[model samples]
Target: MAKLSPKNLHCELVVTVDEKINPHIMRDRNTGQIYADDDYLYRLKLRSEKRVIECDGLRYLDHSLTVDEEGNQELVLRGSCPSGERTEVEVVHRFSIPVRGRYIEERITIVNCGKDRYYLEDMRFGFRRGLCPAYEPGQLADDISRFRLVAVPYRKVGISQDKGSPSPGARPSVKRQEYTMEDMIEGKFSNVDWRNDETVVGQDLVDRYRLRSEGWAWTDGRCGLLIVKYNDEMIEYSLVERNGYSRRECLVFGGAGFALYREPRPASVLEPQTKVSFGPTRYIFFDGGWKKAFYLFRDFMAEKGHGLPDGYNPPVNWNVLYDIGWYHSDREKLFKHYNLEALHREARKARDLGCELLYLDPGWEVCEGTTLWDEERLGRVEDLVRTLKEEFGLELGYRTIGRVYRDEFPNEWYIQRSKEKGQYIRPIGSDGKPIGFWEPCTECREWWEEKLRRILGITGEGVKFMMFDEFDWRGPCFNPSHGHPVPSTPEGHVRAVYRLIEEVRRRCPEVLV
Candidate 1:
């Protein structure tokens, strides 16, 4: 029954809504424009207590809009709904189309607005405009198949289908994938939950760069929809079907919904007047293929201060760890294969061959992953770096395992200490009981801090680059002493990793992560 229309150099965004404050059409002025969409951009995906909350379904309320000095526009719509006469909740949805960047951001705040509490679950935010109403439901689904859906799952060693990194004008690492609607129906493509080593391939065995991809893209040939779950802890890229453009044909892509690591805890009370911020879910529409859209996203990220410094230059050198088969070691030969003199000689040879740096992968630490270096074998890391520079004029770097080596490192000491403090990763049971065996709980604040200190210590030894191998420690942790949720979630693990990485950057900003 109401609408809001805005125009800019990108395109004109016409937002139409009904009594429920749901946006029906977000038609772009020019379909062929770089940032234009072919149809009503998409509808929002939402749910509470298993009941779908559509824009037209709820009773419409009040709406308003505001524009800043920079020409950024934010539309706020407010409405209220009762849950079968029990809890009454108010919803305030804010859709912001920024003056800059290639994506439009969305955030929804749900408040009880009543004396009682409200619970929302499995809520995913996505877009779904009626897809070619001229076609039948079955036919629409068929049409969606023409536009392939690209799902990017997060992996430490992401098996990229691309050639190189996304440095400047280099060929972007775009992993083009097409998971069918059949895959969504059968639950084959799961992007939210973390997969273990059994399901994950080329993780601990091989070494590769991290893609940080947990998103999806739908593209035909010229234009498409891009919904990326960028750096949000509570969200995951999803493709589950919902009420949308078709009965069953309209496929949803690049949307985010709630993904639990384990059984979710009971919903806490939403006190009256308390506002909950749902998302800033990223949406980008662009001309050409999905690559062009993704590149726009990449550029947006750089504009947001994630890119390198103005004049920073990275040294792309060789790592003798994985190729030479020295990555995984139980110290069978000790340092005989890679001792101080051997590394010195190798550095001399490699330096002469124009290798900018010599990476002392393994066999440098006295114990596997231990900060202590062997005096007799590789000598001190500082001394080795000085020798690598002084003797061979080579740059210095280090690579270490994130986990303590079972065969070589002293695990008993760590285990006994953990046992004494009742702080091991117990993974099951709500009673905070041990689940038999254990892996060092990275979620433990102490353990995380220790790793931070360890990384900074090594970086202070003048390391140019540090490779954190086997870092994605996964599983449910029931140990309450670790100071994480009863069952550690994928999001919790990711947040912990991000925090630790941030801390390292804060302390040692010069060292390459």
Candidate 2:
């Protein structure tokens, strides 16, 4: 048995290697509580085989403690997967214990060593099994009923537009769910990927479990593990949950192991001598309950440059759409209520309410996705800024989006969802006509430049805030001329969006986006 107890962490980790190596023990040193033991660390399936193989089944080759690029000391375990008479794959599991941070970083690498190509069906990592549920009570641990899964949803939930507006005091709340062993088994740890489901792309609804990059926390009210993944690929892999067994149940974390069909859409293949990596999944351990865990996570993110600037106090914006009503793209109501006169009245209300800014929703755009300021209906952007500041003492801001209510671009600039024989010009519906609306591909260089230029034009006209909404990727584009891949990938799309934001900040440093 080899043990590692980092001085900064409150937990102890260990691995046992006699015949096979298993990095499989986590113990909270505070109360002498043991969380996992002799657990299977990873599970991966080969395309040709029906049997899912685990890390424990691999023959142990060697183990060592090495320093990684980030200067953290890591425990590295190497193993080889065997076929009938030969070694086919090499697996390496790494656990990095940060000397200054209260967390462990886990990553797995699978290198194809066989002569033939290998198509991976699935891959999952973490403490693969345990003697009992993590929430189960023992002399050294808290009761099972006291355990809770605390998640701060990545998007708005519990508030629905169709059901009518919530009261003025209503706000989005955190989801704190209590679960039994059965509930954990039923839900497992499957992640929700919005890009895979096209039907729900533009639909409005409530969802609490959207797999966000921010990550989630699981707690027993005394100690907890905060799992965060930095990957922003088009599809999301499951992380953190429990799996059930008749005689033994395991609390799984980091990688869920089950592969979703759409995440690696157009399934990827590992050619011979190729290396595929899963994650640099982080497990941040903390004492106390979920709130403390969240605060710690926030601090961790801040350290990673995701936090707001120091001493930057945000202003309270008064969105008039709540009072005037959400007309969406309805031209009739928009023309009647979204003009300057109506907005002036709303500006007065914002002034009266001590609001610092008057935020426009969807009606300020020439078209919903145009990002062009409707100077004809809303007056010039400069005038709106002047009146709001000089007359009502409020700053000016508006919403910018990705999907267009009307097709305002060349056919090639929009998303190409189909490459059928007759679908060359535009996306052909089942009925053989062009799709009604257009979703601009962020990865399209022309559209990307145009969108950035338009957004900068408005912000340059003294707009203090810009609310980026409705920019979710609907699907991939199949346009070869767009300067992206023939079928645009989620990673490319996300990077384009990030590049857009970065460029905006670079040009308009003072503007809050």
Candidate 3:
């Protein structure tokens, strides 16, 4: 067992590691509490329900903090699970609890070591039992009655208009939820992806409805367990709070939600010699109640070593993404007679409402595909920026469905152009045509140049902030043209986007993405 107390960490952790065995049950010093621990460390069924992985039986080989190219150190643990056959599969787990930070984040990776091809149905990393559920004088049982909060970034309810060029027809009113336990448990609740219906949970919702990248928070009112999920990939987590095993309050079991699906959306295959992993589900144990959970999560995010947003502080300064229509334009509201005036009013309204910035989404583009502002149809971007800042004294922000729109300007211009510079493009299709208009290959040189130019251009034009929405870029570009393997992947795409965003900061050091 090895203990780690990263610098300035208000807390310390004890990890139980043994040769030929994965680390289990890491307890904190204050509460003697354990999370993502060994009690049920390797809980997912690998091939089938009967073939669940027994990590305690697996062989632990190495654990170290490897320095990434940027010279930052990362904690990584490696182990192997025997298939009860010829080849041994390697399991790589990367994790860390930052100095004085409140979360224990560990990503999952399974590599095929042997020559035999592997097929895995589902894999869940953490079993969600016994994770900081406390009891008090309340009549409710501690386990079943403890609170669980799920943060829905955007839950559309009805039609609505928001700060934008105003397309009322396109904007849907979002019913942002303050979810109680019932609302979450009743939703399509399977956190694990494969063979979901096979479990006691019936087919509750479609694949999209599953809501993989959910922000899950659990607390017994004293200490709390909040998992900040950043993507809809392998980091998905399940939260069940109902009458079940162990706890009279409720049994809240969760594992890493990152599972691979086959027919609809696919999870990565555990083929021999291939590698796949995702974690870093940020969690925190703060000194407060459920009311402050969201606030706490936001503060801890900057500390998780992921880059912080511009002026990344909390009571997160306020933006307009979730309160109303996700910044979509209502064509009727946007191009109408009161277009510019309406924007002026909205900007003033946001300012008066105490918002620091007004977020405009999906409307100002000349067409859905073009990044150029629709000056002719919706007035000049320069005028809008001046009004928002000069008149309203609020920062100007904007976003599009994806960075590059396909409706007008095909991705080909950037794709072909970038490719000429030995850059890569993410073809929207398996057809290999480099014609994915809706999706830009961030790996391509054009993507980087255009983003930098666009950021600087918009910032220079008085825009201070941006969200490259709909950039849920697909992984590890299989485009060998992108300098990756022939079989491109989601990871590659993610890295490319990260690089571009970093470049955006370097060039427009003041602009926020």
Clashing pairs in 1: 19-60, 22-55, 42-128, 43-127, 43-128, 141-249
The TM-score-based order of candidates, best leading, equals 2, 1, 3
Compared with the true structure, the alpha-carbon lDDT of candidate 3 equals 0.50
Task: Indicate which candidate wins on lDDT.
Answer: 2
lDDT of 1 by residue, 29-135 (tens): 34543222222222333344434543323344678889999998888877665234423566676777877644566665666665543445334434554343433
Q: What is the TM-score of each candidate against the true structure?
A: 0.71, 0.77, 0.51
Worst 10 residues of 3 by lDDT: 193-202
Mind sharing the TM-score for model 1? 0.71
Q: What lDDT score belongs to each candidate, Candidate 1 first?
A: 0.53, 0.66, 0.50
Q: For model 3, how does the per-residue alpha-carbon lDDT over 1-513 read when each residue is reduced to its tens digit?
A: 554333123333334456554444444455544443333345333552234454334556777765455433357777776455533567777766554455666566677776555555444455434322234213433343455454432222343343346564564545533454544444434333322112112233333333343455555566666666554443343433332223322333343543223211234356656776554555566555555676765565555655555767422134443333332334554466335555566666687777877776656665453566767665777777776678777777777444443433334423332223443344433344544344455666555566556556655676677676566543323334445444444455566667766776676666677
Model 2 lDDT at residue 305: 80
Question: How many backbone overlaps does candidate 3 show?
Answer: 40
Ranking of predictions according to lDDT:
2, 1, 3
